[model samples]
Target: MRKVILLFAVSMALSAGVRSAEELSVDLMQSIEDTNKSLSSNIALSNKQAATADAKELTQMFAQVETFFDHKGDAKNAVDLARQSKELSTDIVGFVAVNNFESATTAATTLSRTCRTCHTFYKKE
Candidate 1:
């Protein structure tokens, strides 16, 4: 039946989209981890320029994550966590601009923890 074929096609498209999203999220996660480590090191060294750049990149990435969750429409807590992490990234940029590495470090730690919390709750199989 045409109805059955249409339903099957729609189901296939959705499954493919889910698979693609998972792959993209995995790549994004790896990049975030690398950037987070670089950010911590930059903060420790008091590298204002590098730290600012890292924080900005983190903010952008978290925004992407927030958008991803928002589109999925199933993970409210994940969306909130991503937003909180994005705010922390922005805070880190401000702290680095002021040469306040201590506060920036603290914010980075908080951001890392926020990421862990989200992963714990919303990790993909």
Candidate 2:
């Protein structure tokens, strides 16, 4: 009985870990898309405050992406891309904070490119 109880506990723990990992991946991807939309809309409307907020969210999301890829043992190139994208997001945040739409737009473009490049290698069709 004790052995069976132990096995059940271990199984539950493992399942919970798997579920949380899957949820994290889904949440991160959704967050990235949402952040992009928010940033684009805010920039187009010249809403510096909202754009800054969006940039901040993207920056954090990219960091999470980097960590997720690293933990998944993804290719080194993909991990590097994630890290580069995170850096670009930070730049976007800074640019938006200063109301520098031009620089922010450029950085955001680079961020998208990095994401596309990584996705090309790893994302499912």
Candidate 3:
């Protein structure tokens, strides 16, 4: 009975990890959407502080995604793109801090492209 219980517990833990991993993609996408919305809105309004905050949030989300990839042992494939995404996000924040919406918009485009490139390899339907 003890052996059976141990096996069941391990199975349950593994199942939970799989479920959480599946959910992580959805959460990451939502975070990206939020960042885009905030970035566009703040830029249009020339709200430097808000745009900077959004960019910072995006950087954090990308870091989380990187950690997730590492956990899945897919970091070898995604590390560069993930790093680029985070760097572009930081660039966006820096541009916004200087009230350079044009540069920030360009950085945002690069960041979006990096995310798409990474998704092409890893995102499951």
Candidate 4:
């Protein structure tokens, strides 16, 4: 009876450990999805005629990307990738603010590539 009880407790603890790892992976995936959405929205806004529209959407999307990094645990590589992405976004916003559509478009393209690289490295199959 003692051995059986001990085995059951160990099994439960192992299952919980697996579940926590799975949960962390899920959270990371969700953060990636949110970043993708923000990137797409920024791209669309870049093509808009109104500078105000572009500025507003770009600011909001960049904010969303930044928020994803807040309170993120010690995932150093992931954090670095996100920081690169945010830097590109900052450049894009600056270009758009100056009405430099060409530069903004180039920055956006680079930002997309950064996002893809990060996803490939960190996200699971």
Q: List all candidate RMSDs to the true structure.
A: 3.1, 2.6, 2.5, 5.8
Arrange candidates by TM-score, highest first: which order?
1, 3, 2, 4
Q: Count of backbone clashes for each model?
A: 0, 0, 0, 0
Model 3 clash pairs are none
Model 4 lowest lDDT segment of ten: 47-56
| lDDT (tens digit, per residue) of candidate 1 on 1-125 | 99999999999999998887754467788899999999999999999999999999999999999998888787899889999999999999999998899999999999989988987888866
TM-score of each candidate structure, all chains considered together: 0.85, 0.79, 0.81, 0.52
* Model 2 lDDT per residue over 7-119, tens place: 99999999999877644476678889888878877877779888888878887887887787677674688679888987887888788777788888888778778878887
Which has the greatest lDDT? 1
Sort by lDDT, best first. Answer: 1, 3, 2, 4
Q: Which residue ranges in model 2 land beyond 4 Å of their true spot?
A: 1-24
Determine which window of 10 residues in candidate 2 has minimal summed lDDT.
19-28
* Cα distance off (Å), candidate 1, residue 11: 7.2
Judged by whole-model lDDT over C-alpha atoms, candidate 1 comes out at: 0.91
Model 4 spans > 4 angstroms off: 1-74
TM-score: model 2 vs. ground truth: 0.79
Stretches off by above 4 angstroms in model 3 are 1-9, 18-25
Query: What's the lDDT for residue 80 in model 1?
Result: 97
Model 2: pairs clashing at backbone N, Cα or C within 3 Å: none
lDDT of 3 by residue, 1-125 (tens): 99999999999999998888755678678878888777877877889988888988888887887787777674677866777788888898888887889988888877777877877987777
Alpha-carbon lDDT, every model = 0.91, 0.80, 0.81, 0.61
